[model samples]
Target chain A: MAVRVQREAFDIGAEIDRLRAGRTSVGAVASFMGVMRDFNDGSGVQSMVLEHYPGMTERALESIVAEAGERWPLIDTLVVHRVGELRPSDPIVLVVTLSAHREAALAACAFIMDFLKTRAPFWKKERTPAGERWVEARASDDRAADRWQEGDGA
Target chain B: METAHGSVRVLYFARLREAFGTSGETMDLAPGLCTVADLRERLALRGGVWAEELAGSRVVRFAVNQTLCPPAHALSAGDEIAVFPPVTGG
Candidate 1:
């Protein structure tokens, strides 16, 4: 498993190739990418600044990936989250899960993103027409993360 | 940078950073400040924005030494405390 939080942009295709370089057991690859949007809360956003607690951000991400591993049987997992300034259409995150079957890879990829949305320490500040404002935490995200609980009847 | 003998570092992030008007501070350990909740209360006692942002009624979260921790987690000298609102990143 690999978890990375960096300010640099990443190429998803290259990342997948690098991770699955010599893994012959991999049969399924499920991936999810989050992109920056131009509008939010009814305002036109021009740019965004991602903020995080240096030491804690990486730790939180690693823990999330670790939790994903505990819940799924996998060949490997990669989580790459971007920080710093970003524009609309910029890729924000990428999660890839490789497994022997499609079921494990697909579910684990979704699970990792759900967990990252809630558990991770990163925050976003969007520059809109009016002014720069911090993005509000959504209740929907909490609901999304909630379904992953052990006894959560999805 | 200077190090204090009996102090805990408190960090503010995101909205809390703007609301509280500072990024971080070195607070000396106090007699009654024993847990994360206690430290929060003491900071909230500053009233106004500090109280509003640090208030328990708000959706606040805490981390002790980079670990997300509960309010009851004990505080210690040299510990790093972070206070922030709920995360919104994807």
Candidate 2:
């Protein structure tokens, strides 16, 4: 398992290749990439700033990946979350899960993302047409995270 | 016995930092001030923004020693406490 919280842009292809290297046992890789959108909540977003709790953020990501490991037969898991200023279309986060079967890889990928959405300490503030505003936590995100608690795998 | 006093490192993030105008501060806690809620009430003594931002209905989250915790969680001397708005990340 590997987790990175950085300001530098990440190359998704390179990261996947690194995980695939020397791993003939891996049959599936599931990945998710989150990008900054040009608009949100009826406003045009100019840019975004992500703030995190530094040490706590890394610990939280590690814990989330660890939880996924316990639930799935994951060969490898990687999470890369970017911090600081970013523009529209910029990659904001990435999650990659490798497993012998598609089911484990796919489920673990979604699980990691679901937990990370609400449990992580990162916060986003968008520079919109009106002014800069902190993005509020969506109710849908809470519901997404809550569903995992009701079941064993998902 | 003397009334005990201890200091905690309080951190503010996101909007809290923007409102408080500082990233963190060292607060001296009085004895018997145990839980996160107690500390918040004490901090609220500053009134105005402090009281308004930390109002009961506001969406605030707390972390004690870098771990997310509830308001009733006990606090300890030399602990690192963080106060921030609800997280919005993916």
**By TM-score, who's the top model here?**
2
User: Which candidate number would show the highest DockQ if scored against the true structure?
Assistant: 2
User: Against the true structure, what is each candidate's TM-score?
Assistant: 0.94, 0.95
Residue A102 displacement in candidate 1 (angstroms): 1.2
DockQ of 1: 0.77
Model 2 Cα shift for residue B24 (angstroms): 0.7
Which ten residues in a row are the worst by lDDT in model 2 chain A?
Answer: A145-154
Q: Lowest-scoring 10 consecutive residues by lDDT in candidate 1 chain A?
A: A145-154
lDDT score for candidate 1 against the true structure: 0.90
Write one digit per residue (lDDT tens) for candidate 1, span B5-80: 4889999999899887899999998778888999889999999998877765888899999998999998889999
